[model samples]
Target chain A: MDNTNEKLGVGLLYNASLPEYLEHNIEQVDYIEIIPDMFWSDEGRNAYPRFVDLPQWRHQLNWMAKQVPLVAHNIGMSLGTLNYFDKGYIQFMKEMNESYRFRWHSDHLSFIKLPTKGPHDHNAGIAIPVPYDKDYLAMLREKISFITEQIELPFLIENNVYFVEYPDQDYSETDFINQLVSTNDQANILLDIHNLYANSVNHKLKARQYIDELRMDKVVEMHIAGGNEMGGMYMDSHAGPCPDEVWELLDYAVSKAPNLRGITFEFHESYFPLLRFDGLNKQIEMAKAIWNKYTLQPYYHELA
Target chain B: MNSPDFQLAFATLIASPQLCKQAIADEPSVFDQFALTEKEKTRLRSVLRQKGMSICCSLYRMNRITPLYTQLTQTATLLGDELITLAEEFWESYPDSSLQFKEEVLAFGQFLLAKLEVGTLKFPYLQEILRLELAINELSYTPAIIEKTVHFDYDIVAILLAMDRGTLQTERLQKVQVAYKVYLEEQTLKLALL
Candidate 1:
């Protein structure tokens, strides 16, 4: 749905290498979300090999920013951890933000580490779902505040796909998220559609109803992807195209997300072939058709 | 052929519906091999005989079949050496043999190589397949012949066979093999330069 006043943007997370992705596909979409870790190199603190140096990355990012608004979707910033935030990572992210001049940055509202004295478990540096409890909420607010203060850009927190059941959770996922957003006024929410879909499928909840209850005003961006059904659980596998159900949810989300700045299409290289440009073209066409059917005004910037 | 350990190990490996589909796809008779215990075999067979191969096939298809392929390659590599050594000695003794005789010998070599590669003629399970392939190549023919004709080496060939049979395990290996196969396919494009 192309709303002239609202920022209706189509995004691909970290698909910069594929020429067709940038030249062919992204041309049709609006705004691209780059995972800074993918481009980071060993040279400088946040040196990304893809960009070579800060100056080069700046030029490329600026160029992309000029084409359409650029947003940084980070995977490394473990927001829900009990441990202190990585100062090196924070500094690097700040530097990249300054260099790229991103619209806004967001990370998963999950823990990637535990407070330990020895070397951190670098291997398990994956975004893990946090227990939906008040204790966690208190810790999370402090972390979000610290991040927002360091980086002037609006810090957005994303909902994660939790596999294991939480026994000690004091509130529902929605309540926890709503509380976090309310406490941290500057913080926005990155509504990952697939994670929502997965949680609903696994936990047996209505996906739309969950979206209906979401604090949509705080949502700065949205993530959509495909999932794999395993052990009766729908794992968020970004290997294939988004299913019809997820698309329907996105349509519902668009109406709900009043302050939604952008919508990101998350796909990983491992499952890139399943999308096959032709198949992806059809999906994009479907998305466009849906957008056209819903929104009354078709803005030129919406296409950009 | 029917042993408790073999049945237990094989049954455990193919316990998952996805794993059973892959095992059956690779070797249709693999299910029959487990016929020693009808109860266990029937349970495994029912999973495979389901209406939709969606869940099992998708899981198998998504996972990289490289480790299984690697295991097959290792077997072939070792067998290739034995076959080459035997063939060379036979050929050297009877250098002026007829075409029929030559064909017979070559057929025997291929058969032995195939059987060994399939993990039937086993000693080194999966880990030593590569080393055995190299050893066989070294023992079997001249370096020039191997360098010029053996583009895949024993390890690569074994992997390809395992992939074809759908017996490969481990997702990471499958991803690597898929990329490697794509790389192999791209080599044909390079031939245009010639």
Candidate 2:
């Protein structure tokens, strides 16, 4: 099946160094989403994804897995880039999956490669977006298909934020996503509301318009988070409280994405200190209220 | 645009605002370096014209230098105006960055150490500071014991310990014989003076 049969309610992105406040509120979160890239160091450029000197991180990840259901949210897999692929990064994911037995795994829909990954592939220093076009879609199809064959769990590509405006193309951003789903059966959308909200504001588009247009059934998981505003531009900085605009979009989106299994709250570690304990719980509580509603239906599976 | 050309264009334009402007102006000579197709060049021009490319550069520069600022506070403070120039040179020398932050940082330290040895870097304390920072990184990333001998008017150990231990930075003009040992225990590097 394209989507998971199990259910995953509201969860918090787990960093080993979570605030002391969250320790008391651990039970408030249903599950934890772990970004493997954060825990393991891919030793220098040509080391080919070798884990380096992260003994403490390995211990923490092992401990966290025993506590609750842990899902792998990968930040390193640059699935959209076509020419060169990081076979080592793929291998790392496979090894991690074997150890953690993550219910599912996801990566950003952007390209982030080490210099050694390809010839003439300059490092972008950040997870920048890929172009929206038919050839681009074809590239993703082949890459994603290979990933699906290698990793058994359901894989998702989170809707990433892009600052660049490509010249007009055959597909809108929504159309590009829809085509991606049509290409691979196991592939699904990780629908990041905050990213969508940021893109809408930055590009002067409608959140509702894109949400209604997308094939919501393909959305197996969703993400919501807060970001910082620098120089009048809303960034996907993942810095602070969930913006009102994202929450507003979430209120409308929850009903539309019927197959949605998980809704994760993402915030960077630097921003953890800026957020109050009460505020974090309220965001979880808000997600719970919505999860509690849809979960009442027969369509929603039991929480894993 | 094909993936290779597009990826190359992104890397070039993001790293250099001057190239973005050149590409925007339809300067074939500038974008030819990136192997950009005519269509890719046009799209890149459109995007860079939106003025977000500068923001991208700023955001990336901030992420890159954040660790340097935190770890090399004294070095950065001492260099002041030259720090930016040093960083740009380092970036040019080693364009590829690792996701492992300490790797990127240690590489910069290595670059400085090379510069210092080659007489390209002229500073009173460059050698000592680079040695101390690189030693800390070495200790963190590996358990291999490090033994070194050096002489200086200032106490390098005291300044390093002060950064984390809050010990006061004491100034003493003395050429003292000392042995330095560094190793990791419980995620903290233990520096022993013998």
Candidate 3:
């Protein structure tokens, strides 16, 4: 899957409010990035057909798939979970790809699902950041190999937004990501600029320095969004439009990431009222400006 | 360092602030259930003391309750400020959420139904609204169009409208027993008076 020359312009992460928006403005979007898990319901491990399609959601997804190219952003993989791996979930993803024909797929570098004694697995209710240690990296590498074998799509791991950082980690976040992608050919990065901004505000770190340390070529996609202040900390709540700082970071990131295929603007559907169709268009327009600035000319000329 | 156990312990702490407080207080048996390595235990203890842990716990509760808020809008809106305490109690009883929207909504709906049946949760038209919302959730997942009926003993439309307006007054509304058929037709929720 050589996406080096592929450049998908500004896109939106699919949400419940998107059907109506996409209906009127399909041409404005280059592609749709969907969370495949949202389109189906997983009955517990005991159920014969463990994954059931929610017709209403599938109807919407089918409608959108016809309108534009789609990429899957998954939340169920939980690849960082230590000993537990749901090959069944990966198998289901393969079936979904067969049906939808996604361009590429990605999941977070964090764990959310924990196996429980009950019939269903326990959701951590949040994506928990994994410790950047050699042992965990090795664990993820094996899991990534299995996933790539099962589904031949380009796989990406999004950098996590950590509210709490573990003590005595083996590597910094950028080094960890660089090492992981260096070892796995099919694995790359989904550079979430908002998550980096959140971490910068919360931890008092330089976001640019963090970005500079990263292997820019590994970045295939980037996410930008708005968040609000909670408990005196700037949180990545995805509440509304992208902040000015996020746009700046995205501009810098886009200039560096030559292989970047998409700049996805994410906002929770509940915030649809805040970012009505017009507001959403504004975000996409801003992203396209950055995209065109870097993607229109030769990479070297743009840098010069 | 026993990554599974460490994850379990961390997840448990996030879901229950009571356990988090105990862990912070250095309660001897707070983490007796997990087989965590000493380093893991030390890390958990240190992390719990950070202010971000509070945010993590808040985020956990918000995520668990989102399905309920989205699916059971009328029931949740009617519960008003009481939803927080009720949700906390519900989480205390059932610590793990499947994270599936229908499953979480149904689980929370069943929890509310049990409370309403036992006379512990009392309110005018509460049962009717809850049953309607739960039916809608169930029907959204059901592929085939099928009708399910709910009997309401009050002027349900007036009640719902007033609730939407945030000016619900049960005493001002009239009592009228009626059965409404709730079903999904062509992927759209429709209601018919029966």
Candidate 4:
């Protein structure tokens, strides 16, 4: 297969543990996705705007940014929070984007911070699932709009792997995602196939039906990663190579998503030995073969 | 108005397992301080009674535990038998887990130090190990960490070498009058013992 699909490209998420793999196969992948939080240390904060010290990662990251196509995937946006918008976080993102010039920015749909004024105003410290209600849609839409205006980039939200049950008034999870993106054309989706699969299996929902329900036309990028079972619940762990189920979803997504631009693989640093050393090249080969099938066969009537 | 309150309440409950236990029981005043509406209170009641407990506890604890494990490896090792229980105790002591890695680690280290200062924690190597770990964390991933040349206040190397592996002795370490410089060079921590 060729290096990239003219329409869609394959990429690796930049995990620090796999420098050898990244360097060895630099030409193989077309782009690199990076998490912004790793580049800086948080100083103390009191007011709305918090200052961070970034002298450490400046030179190294700048050098990496020049190497491949850098796309922004932030974990700290806390978009579902009811109280705070994290304007400081936005400012930091803007500054980083200015330096790296990322193609597009995306964050998870989960709420990492509880924004209300109370004792525990600190971030929830993990991507906590948000309620899938139409009532909450207005809030998330406004937040997305605010983020869009502030970042001035084509923004997207990845589907969250939710475990909890929240009271929903109207919309199911897919309904919520579909309506959210359909409201604005520019707003897109980074359909994390692993997350979708994990959530479906964990919650006893049909995985294929979930994919069928998604507004695939809105999907711009897709994520493939591995997970593990913990406490009888499946996690979007990113701990190993792509599971067969996720690969199948990737094929389905590639066939369905007309506007898809990227396919990225993710794994935590702890699994570098297993995934990077053993399975990375094979994963890339499989992804390339599928990318051939995906981009080769026409998905859109106009293109055909 | 209610959603914000509900979020805050749920976060608080997750952070405080004791309060969650109380809220789960048939206690009306357990959630009095929380700013929850009637509907929100009903939902909280449902969560406590019927669903979401497993993930709620796992998510809350895992988030807090990640940095703790990463930062305080030696201290965690030192408290081998008491690690799990003490971790929970430390978390309960400082309930609000911060995303700031340094602050959270430092605070937990200090909490252990306080436990050592009192008769609460009886681990002999806790103090030096925690201090050394904290310094390493502060220095970060750089190749070298430099500090102003000064006479050593703590003789960490001797305490480490002389201390028996058995019993994890409780005798207070005598601060040896030695001058030394500690820094990382060539990815190794070098101590200039004088």
Best by lDDT: 3
CA lDDT of B190 in candidate 1?
Answer: 10
DockQ of every model listed?
0.03, 0.46, 0.69, 0.43
lDDT of 1 by residue, A183-273 (tens): 7767889999899988788767778878877788788788888888776667787867898888989888876665667777787666767
Q: What are the per-residue Cα lDDT tens digits for candidate 3 across A81-161?
A: 988999899999999998888878999999999988776888999999998998998898889888889998788999999
State which candidate, 2 or 3, has the greater lDDT: 3
DockQ of 4: 0.43
Per-model lDDT: 0.57, 0.74, 0.87, 0.73
Model 4 spans with C-alpha error above 4 angstroms: A1-8, A47-56, A115-121, A298-304, B49-52, B141-154, B158-175, B185-188
Score every model by TM-score. Answer: 0.57, 0.89, 0.94, 0.88
Chain A TM-scores, all candidates?
A: 0.84, 0.90, 0.96, 0.90
Task: Say which prediction, candidate 1 or candidate 3, comes out ahead on TM-score.
Answer: 3
Q: TM-score for the first chain of model 1?
A: 0.84
B20-99 in candidate 2: lDDT tens per residue? 67677766766667677778877776777775677787776777787687666667765778999999888766666653
Q: Which regions of candidate 2 fall more than 4 Å away from where they truly are? A: A1-3, A19-23, A44-49, A114-122, A297-304, B1-3, B70-82, B118-126, B143-154, B161-173
lDDT of 4 by residue, B57-167 (tens): 777787787787888876776777787788789887777665577778888888887888887888665666777777766666322345323243457676556544543
What's the C-alpha lDDT at position B94 in model 2?
69
Could you list the iRMS of every candidate? 20.5, 2.9, 1.5, 3.8
